[model samples]
Target: MTDLHEALRRGRARARYSQDDVGAALGVSRAMVSYWEAGSRAPNDRQLSALARLYGITPADLAEGRDVEPEEIDLAGMLLRADEEIDPGAAPGIREFVDFLQRYAELADLLGIPIRGLAQSPFVHRAKFVQKDDVRRKAEEVRSLVGLGTGPIRDLDPVCELLGITVYRAPLGADLRHAPSGAFLNHPEVGFSILVNLDMTPGRRRFTAAHELAHALFHSNETNRVVSNGRGPRESFADAFAGEFLMPSEGVRRFVEEVGIPPRIVDATDAIHIQRYFGVSWPTALVRLRQMKVVTADTYRELKHSVRPVSLARSLGYSIHPEEYEQDAGLWTIHRFPRPFLRMLRTAVIAELMSPPTAASFAGVAVPDIVQILGRPHGNAEQEQPQVDTEFVEFEATGVI
Candidate 1:
């Protein structure tokens, strides 16, 4: 094999991506990956750039047939290498996610959409280690900065987006039974991005988003990336942040008062009310109550073991959205990607800045579907009268055109 071919093969092996994974990610066929590795066919410039990114190597390293030296590794490359040793099955998905973020940023730039920076947020902090008290304080500060005023953050996705943090829901891999709830990355190219596992329930997904937002706001300076599996001091701090940010202690107290329950004697019914009121999981509500000393240890344990949150919610006349409590509800749905990212992708395709095939791949749709939504591209509208599709423009404003 030629050195370039050997390099390509080595890079794929190092990244632990199967040819099928590479093919699916690149919108190409497995046979094409094989031919590229066998030196029978070469990839074009766009494909080469994508391959280099997927393999966590620079295009120059691939061309020169050299390994990426330790000093030369980018944040995404370092994270991929770390994950290979930690969770091999998750490494491919992580690489794909990073590539997706990079592509999103690129499209935004091409379309002249301003990419928001972390420094732009007045609440941004760079503390390497945060105590529980510090975490609570920071959460409160962030809530105030965002003007949430201790309310049950009905939706965290929009809040994160408003802070310039891109949030996306995608499958990390079914095999990752112990998969991380979510991950965060801070790169010069992508700014701040969080990826939550679509296999998680909506409540858990929201919690994970808040958890990663903590990382994005506070811990990003310590490391360029973090994969939160809910262990260790940093993970603990993130959990505390999520709890305080979503269900503040004062909010919990006011909620208990509103429900006419004594704080020290809160029961399962009270816990259910808190859970539904705050839009958190049952266990999360119980834990917060315990932390706040509203529920005694005995009561907390009893409620934790006895409560069937979803069934209980229904019995109590609370309408439960299955998507909020059921795992995998968000998986393989139209909402797989963040709406903002899809909007930009649609805009790029409509503006002819991105080709239909590429835009389709990014949007997780078929090429024909993209064409059907955005209409055909006219090379020069000035030379020829443009055929305006009012329907296309209408769908763009509605969503995911």
Candidate 2:
């Protein structure tokens, strides 16, 4: 017989929740939760139901350790590589990230989010080698599909969501020096997904998303995985795709003409102007300009050696928020899972198939934050007034605790 206690332990870990958390939600002591998992005791019917809800699994499945049959997808060839050598120490963390992706994919399948965006994937001839014209054409097609209309993509997250591609901003951790900027997975069951390291500059994050999108559309189906470290043929192609996707040649030229920057950029301010308009980094915008022949080779090199773009932008009177210059706040919806997945989680919670703590774990937020996310009233006004009054009286009698 399958060990229900072992199953319970595994389920809780998979959901990223602690024993104490589960116990508190169930109004039981931590010792009871431990006993149930240690096989010294079994949960009764009510406890079982709550446990299943907390784990986002069926009670029968929880008892039997019934997992979705593991699907065969190449787990190999996905990781952090520096100068062509794989970082051996990063293997475990990379694998853990992949495992988390697998769980998310299963959740996506369970939620009925269709496997899509492949037929519309912007690639020609399976992208055996990426060509400039091919990548530009493909990116334009993707832009058109997402209704971008040749303008700057102010936010690329929504377009990714629209393509049935789930994006996650994950902390890739500091263990892997020269780690991959992004990773892509084309789950046979869950469509396409991308994970961009949350530590990158916001502009870089945007670029990484587009780069991972390129891999998802072009490389993922073949090997079932792609890790982008900004090197080699596949990564090179992804970079090209990202550049074009974020900055179309025509739009860029139009902007350059509007801004009246000369063919050879003589100043950092010119690069700043273009980067801000496209929401890309100075280097990216400058490179795009170089690609479009707006700037000469000598000019590109000179600009690269000059003042940093963010500093120049700030000097030029731009507000220059940290996210725009350095790293983005990781908590924003744009930096998290796509709408369909979030919607499914909400539906699961509403149907009582998942508990609040589990949802909070998935959301990377606190329980109280989850309450707010669900749009529930914080508390009854009458119930809160007495507590506030008591707190005020106690503070007056003594002092601030």
Candidate 3:
């Protein structure tokens, strides 16, 4: 009923989030959001703060009902600003990635995390190894600590960051498909990051991030010492971590009661409905549910293997229709370069991230390709190397061949 609630409803409407979406994001029930906006009752102080965070504004901004203006700088630009601030010794890809972390922090502000300071504050010692001093009980305790209430959190990035887990994307162009998607390292220097291939499917991305977060807290930094990225005891531990993080037994029971999912419906098509409501893949959701003893083991296995892999792309509107690739140039006809990569590449050139002739040595990457994508920003092409000294002088970056 308050102006603050009205402004929040408007902001989420512009962002095109469903009623359920506003609820999931603000950590409230859909019924509550509707009630508040309909003038039935106002959100409590905590929910009001959550709404302000979800809308990326101050409580005052929402209370005053100010128009939420679009930010001029995209996340990519904000990343470039981060690049300008951090040490240039970081690999170009790493630099861009760190830029993304800074932006992720900004997004956390929107997703209702009380994030403070820059780049996740290398100082926050929140991540802990899963203490199997009593495995199930430990997981239950974590569930209570983070307050993973009854809401379904489909996106995993915000969840991990909220838990103070670092998620890194490798740009080494390594054979990612063959390589394992999750790894954990408990080193003090690097701290914790669950490295993942950014280009993977959403479900796998979510699962892998959770798996790696387990390693950050449980396993050694060395990937192969006890458990390789492949299946092993380590995988089991990580699996436990994912299970605990994704679905808490008692919490899930509360959710089922709220939605009224019947026992008979639990294994049929209704299985996927419940899974989807949690924003997790059917199998993962069902298994985690069973693991936490929310359902019988027999029911869990039955639901887990009964169905086939459903392509979520179509449901999510990511599927291309016939008109999608209709252009003569084919799919991805328009090539918009990543702004952070471009500037960082330029800075790398100036700092000698590569040798003077590294362009020619750039494996499969072509010189003209760099020039083309990079707007041909360097000096005259008349000279063989095209004077890069000025660029190096400006950025003051250095690298060896």
Candidate 4:
């Protein structure tokens, strides 16, 4: 294992910042930065804090050698680092997310889950989409591959996991406001990874996952990395794919027929009903309704103006928010650690490969919480034999009598 000094050097390298860059950011001489990294000098508390901020890690993570080695920086060929590919403000969140991906790969390897994903496939088109024709066809192909069978996908997570794509949610905050709603990367270690911004509605998140998956299958060849950030030819194609994938044209038509609604949807309640039934956002369902000609464009416009899904769902006594699951007490306390990952950690602790403290640290919880979860004694066991304190002198020994 590397020591604190090596860790410091590696942290800078991982950040891909030159000594001069670090020094300029800190208002110091490049030679001073080099000396500190070379172990000839040590940084004061303030310098250490600044260094930690530059590296986007806690000071303790640097001092304890918890930072990734420089060699591991581009091990996955991070596309998020591509110049001008992503917003500059979002770089930090992507960097932190990449670190989490590294740790996830470690845990998955320990758990022996086969690392597989849709890489740059030969079946993917060499040329970009000229029209929605190819995009819609590819969407159908993906659906068939996932055994979607022209039906509404009940859950997105299982579909992603089945396709060898790992999906994780990152909480919404000011830090991630500029970050892309979803990003796709083809990792050398993990194959393909998709990150969904948890701040979006459940329907929106599902769409984002599907959108990124489109990038993974078709756009992986375009670049090793793609951020599903905004509107463009590529993004437009992905949007078309997501819409088709979630609400198949045939499926929507059949659904409208089954519901026996008139050609025009007159009530907002009917639109909300269809939205909930298909497990899609109200906007998606409304768009599908218009696309299938079940409702006129003017009707769609009117429904969009009058309907608020969350408020309607609450009035109907249903959980309309996708993020509500995170608030459940039964879930693992750490928002970042999914249930399966938590189970893997627990298994490692039970098998004695990891200490309770170590597992607790990884989970961002108290040690006793891990102990209790593992059904182990929270306190240390009592010694079989008690030892006498020699420093406690008896009255006879002290001649006090």
Candidate 5:
């Protein structure tokens, strides 16, 4: 009983919710919440369920006083545990993402499509500070796992989804100092998921997705959640993984050879070609080329100072529109959940397993918008079918028999 009270108090504290906040969310009073936390009172079953949902835990976890494992909890708990590493302003986005995952899982279950677990990889158990060669090898292994043979991954989101990793995009707002470009989580309930900042450009977003995917494949076992800010050794390894996974050495070499350019003379034009072909950022292309020795150090330095990629791509007849690289051109889709998840929401609505307003909240859209999109439920269309008087006319009589 003491352990249960302690667990409840700790859960609330870790969630960073005030007594008043919890009471408001649960439709109770601050005194009631305080009493519950103080072990002087206990919440009823309904309140306990609401509290568990708010704190991103199971009611049983609270009732049984079970020590919630990091992987067993949701993203909210994970974010709160890493509060020191992330900005306070990022909380809203994290909360929205947690809600999105919960809703996504619910809809998936309604549709009988359970969220799959993260595919196993040897790198999952490897050391965190792996060598560059080891990172490249892991990248190759992942590429093969995805059945991508040393080629540019035109779309990384679908690839992650193909490997049983749910990918979502949301605006984390701007917090230059402590902003994270992307996050990855492996939870027992939500399976594996990656959240890339919609604030980034399409190319950068793709890179971030690949980076988080690396963490999903490698560092997930060690840490249930990872927020990438492009710093530290772990981040460095993930970046390397993204570079190699997106543009393998052999693939780049083949591209350069196909371009009919010598290694020493490879310039910004060639780099732009690589960038466009590989669907990666220009700087990434330059770095990969430099690492592969396809361009001399002096040439790499010259290209680094060369023209901006967008202007160069335009001059080179390449379209710079967001749609040119991936389909995430507009960032206004309900919470920017992935297309696959949106489809699932639509299916849930049609199947009458979910309400329009609930689907709207999950989709980040208005109720009317969701209702308009979903229209009537699945059987309603059948019910609306036109009828004819069989006594007045028959099919054979109408057919002139």
Candidate 6:
């Protein structure tokens, strides 16, 4: 009985799976698996291999008791989103598609886990920063202090910069929005940041930034986990913040009054144009318009139903984004990670923090495919620790604090 119990506990947590759940998946009795994990016994070599495969991890990782990078602690986490039984490895056809959405949906609210948007993550802020300081309240004061005046819509970057928030552009996964730390603000430290799925529309990104900001301000005090349910009051508050922050009600009302434009403007570009003036996404603009009842529900439906998203260069001109852009040329989402992080990774060998081998472990290309999401950056940074500004990257800029 070589401390198998501790090993099993670590294994279970690392895999994000429950003991009984693993037992059911492996067609073994819960007691049997328990005994094996508890060190009273060990799984047979074949059984061990089976369990490792079930978790989509190497057997060595399980037996050696290595800390699966926070990102890999996803096997069990997937259950939150899976609408059906999740098969090991990738599934096929519609089953795979639904499973993917289910997992993504599950993560929408579980923000504490790793929903990294880029190859490298922003630096994970330590609890020490917040424990000695009253960070959350300070953050709230900071936002209120900013008192972003009521005005025409504006680009959000300046505000992010003003607040010392750094936005990270993450490759899109099934997860809709992300901020990577739980104690990101328990005391008011500053190493954590928010990461947005670059693949989302400007509309969605605008809302995501606001939602993340909410986490930084309000839930940053939550020392355990983070995730957003896109439909809750919490989310509604973020949307409201994003709307107000991007396009103040005063300005919006004034702009509409000035233009004397009523619900009849059938041109989508006009909507996009207005969003551009405000530095928001087309969808965000449309949704704002819809929310204001600026257009009839039928008109709103015509626009929402018109969106056809794609992420290839050849299709760029012919895609939904372009069509929407035709409606408003300023509709574009900005990528946050930029080229700097990769440069930091290259200097790693000099720093000696990451062994060449260790660095390769979390290499750029991994499961779920990173390239499909972030598009191609100038270069990939392998075996490098992500250096993100947690305050902004971890949550939205205008979310409830």
Best by lDDT: 5
> Model 1 residue 60 lDDT?
76
| Tens digit of per-residue lDDT, candidate 1, span 1-401 | 23888888988765545576678668999999999999999888898888888777778777778866412234455555433334556666676677777777777788888766463335556554676688778998888877998779888878887787888776665444467677887655556788786666666777888889988887764555678776677878888898889899878888778879776865677778788888887777778888878889898888878878889889999987756554654244545566677777778877777798987877667776566556454336444433345566777989975
Q: Top TM-score: which candidate number?
A: 5
TM-score, cand. 1 vs. native: 0.69
* True-vs-predicted CA distance for residue 28, candidate 2, Å: 56
Candidate 3 per-residue lDDT over residues 255-337, each given as its tens digit: 67777876444454455555666667656776666655556777767756665535443454333334322322122111212
Query: Model 5 scores what on Cα lDDT?
Result: 0.74
Badly placed stretches (over 4 Å) of model 1 are: 1-75, 82-85, 119-129, 173-178, 329-332, 349-358, 367-401
User: What does the lDDT read for residue 100 in candidate 3?
Assistant: 46
lDDT of 4 at 7: 75
Model 4 misplaced stretches (Cα beyond 4 Å): 1-70, 75-77, 83-85, 109-113, 118-123, 171-178, 291-293, 314-340, 363-401
Q: What is the C-alpha lDDT profile of model 2 across 1-401, one tens digit per residue?
A: 35889888877655544576567668898899899899999999889987887676777787777864322433433244212454444455455556656666666566666545343355444656767998888888888877898788887777887887877766554433566677876544455778776656666778889999888877643444567666678888888889999999878878878878875666668777888888887768888888877778888898888667777777788777666544545455422556665666677677776788987777556776567556576857568778989989999889676
Better of 3 and 6 by lDDT: 3
Q: What TM-score should be assigned to candidate 2?
A: 0.66
Give lDDT tens digits, candidate 4, residues 1-401.
Answer: 56767777877755656576578668899899888888888888898887887676777777677755323444223445443445565655566556667776787787777556555443475565546667668878888887888778878777877777767666433333455777877665666677776556556777888888878777766555676666577877777788888888777767767988565687777777667777887777888678767788788888889777678877877676545334433332454444455667788898887899988876557887787667664454234113233334455589875
lDDT of 6 at 140: 38
- Per-residue lDDT of model 6, residues 308-374, tens digit only: 4232222433224454343232222222432223233334423565444543333333322233133
Off by over 4 Å in 3: 1-133, 170-178, 186-190, 198-200, 220-228, 264-267, 289-401
Candidate 4 C-alpha error for residue 150, in Å: 1.7
lDDT of 2 at 178: 67
Cα miss at 211, model 6 (Å)? 1.8
